[model samples]
Target: MTGGSGGHGGGRGGAVAAVDLGATSGRVMIGRLTDGIVSLEAVARFPNGPVPHADGLHWDFRALFEHIVTGLAEAVAREPQLASIGIDSWAVDYGLLRDGELLAEPFHYRDDRTEAGVDLVHALEPFDELYRRNGLQFLPFNTLYQFAVDAPVAEADTALLIPDLVAYLLTGARVAERTNASTTGLVDVAHASWDTALAERIGIPPTLLPDLVSPGTHLGRLTPELTARVGAPLDVVTVGSHDTASAVVAVPMADPATSAYISCGTWGLVGVELEQPLVTDAAREANFTNEGGVDGRVRFLHNVTGLWLLSETLRAWEDEDGAAIDLPALLDAAAGVDGPVPLFDANDPSLSAPGDMPARIAAVLRSAGAQAPVGRPAFVRAIIESIAQAFADAVHTAARLTGRRLETVHIVGGGSLNRPLCQATADRTGLPVLAGPVEATALGNVLVQGRALGWFGDDATLETLRATVAASVTPVGYEPRNGGTSL
Candidate 1:
């Protein structure tokens, strides 16, 4: 489920592997569940990211596919009796096929070509109407705009989302997995399928889109040729192909009344899962999304700019300096720094693209009439503070929009490891922050596979898995030392 760096989850020893491909890295994790605990072991891990091109950013699909095969081979070597394989990746970006061959390199969602297409499409269908039909947020990089800009979609024989494409490569089976496809603006929320009318409206050939398949269905076995080459079983099962969906599946749903999750990594998706999608006008107005989850649930959430902002800033700093700073030590130092001045909105589009974040953040702070940090610790403080404030805003908005008073906010993913950010979120949101299962996406991916493969029967099985591996970190409640505010 980790579409960022890690591939995670399969129960302790029933025999399954998840090929989790993310923006930064890819991994093949072998999972097995025994005595109600899911244990994952990494069989192979590799570095991955977008390749910058003259047109924009492009994914090296061939390289990624090769890495996936290698991982699967490693998994089989580690556990020769693998039951089935599942693949999940970051959502929205896709590949097109003509004559059953990939037409060109898959475009990265971060491509600038989608800049004006959202407004252009809304001019045709109106924003609210689109939202009502799709239940998706208005990110410019959404698949709709990307497809809209690349009109004449009819030329391609098929369109495949990232993970689906990976599954297709393994099994020679084609499907548009519902969980990930839902992230595309082209999917109809109410129908849970690709909107043919919307495709026509966007000038894409309806045939380009594949048949919609729900999660937990087996796509097919890995192709015989691939199996022979890799020396492993080629069978692949489609779990929640989308990383977020798989991550939400792993969220330990302890109490429906109190638990919420922040799937924090590339994008800090913060929300609660519901039995059904909340399609109210308030949800639409608040720009919240109701994405599909495993087993017919909805992930009511908001996609906030996450550690991308912090990591990019750090990368920029490292690029300028010859050496890399110690991240954990720097964060500890930042936690001790004072006078952060004011935090800027992390959603600023300026920070959305690849850039010199340290300079850009400083410029924004200066323009806002706030003092910018000079030292590394102070800079780190600003980034963490900004993330905490954003988390606070998102949690508050999610509560108001969904009409649920979130009792506890669960911070999962890598960001949850940031003690300062977790404490700040707890302080700012005035809620108990339970942090852990840093590999929630992988855990979720593994649990879904466990359920689908009959390793466990029901939700209780998942709870047991969580109880065995998930660790809890209580927030160090921040009080108003100066009596101004608690956050």
Candidate 2:
């Protein structure tokens, strides 16, 4: 089965716009599908980050919305006959609305405000029981805890995930796209619906959440004002609104049965695809998450403190030296040096927030009774090595918890472009690594829109969608060096 012509006058080869928002940056891409081949071109790209204020760190939602509008206009200019638009972003953060007005800027998940709430939630509902109900990894920043820390304003009438809020801003439609909603820690893993009882216990109103809808649901036409502003009439369709969910949908797994993926970006989401949620004591003990995937699959994964470690370290260096470091050169230098470096747990809570990352890393090393790296290159190597080790641990845990034999590790997103990281992951896991489709999140966003518009036929399966992606992009492969697994 394949996508067929359904919307616009572009026949089956129409283009769709994807708004992919990340923690550090965001991009609007135009995905052109010809026959069964998909190609993507970035229309606009912009930096995105938290804004610190008197209270705490929060997203600059207004600026981000303006960027989205600008990107959509750019896409319209490039492809006047765009079929539709889909949006995806990091999960767990959301905007509150009262009488159709945004209440305030959404809090960034990394804000320390949730610390008190985390303890409160665990006290109310034991961690194991909560995990059994939601099957979610115990992330301190999950929406449930965030709400516990500071519940939405009483007047707020609706709560929308980041992507859903963006879509609402574009089309004046309000709906909770399921894939992203699953990350809230307030949804029932078995029923795929909001756990109203749980929400009430957490002091979040059931009325605040909008009706849940699945991926590929046509949200509606873009608002008339937006249409005129963008010079195109595009329907806003829901993809896997969670960026990781969209990335997983675009993972070109050659053999689904024996493949796992690391949607490596600011964070590394490492796990395997499962038909059902893995809600066992083992899974909880490993702190593995079961986020929703496209087509109702479970994204059974672990969130590893990913490139943020290196990125933060670099940021600290740039701030201290008053100059940007040449990343490629530093990586090359790190790769050339061979020696023993201390490995710290990347998931440590102390390293979660933005600050002096290099010093924090050294502190972790010192506390562990290990010598800290003396130079930037050595620090870079240590960070990368620590990330690789974490990835290996997650991969092994996913396999053991799910009883699957892993054969390949697919590293998608920006991290795929890092050769040293890819090679390190392969060496650490003792498994071949396939890395590419750097725009997996956007591709997945567009693919879901394509399918919903009947660009892909009704019979199109996830495999067919991935086949299109596989045929369109070539992946780079890395062979493992060591014979045994590092874990």
In order, what is each prediction's RMSD in angstroms?
A: 4.3, 2.3
Cα RMSD (Å) between model 1 and the true structure? 4.3
lDDT of 1 by residue, 301-409 (tens): 8889999888888888888897897999998999899754479988888888888988888888888898787788888888888888888888888877777767777
Provide TM-scores for the models: 0.92, 0.97
In model 1, which range of ten residues has the least summed lDDT?
1-10
The candidate 2 region of ten consecutive residues with least summed lDDT is: 1-10
Best candidate according to lDDT: 2
Quote model 1's TM-score. 0.92
Instruction: Report the Cα lDDT for candidate 2.
Output: 0.89
Residue-wise lDDT of candidate 2 within 65-123, one digit each (tens)?
Answer: 99999999999998888888999999999998988999899999989998898999998
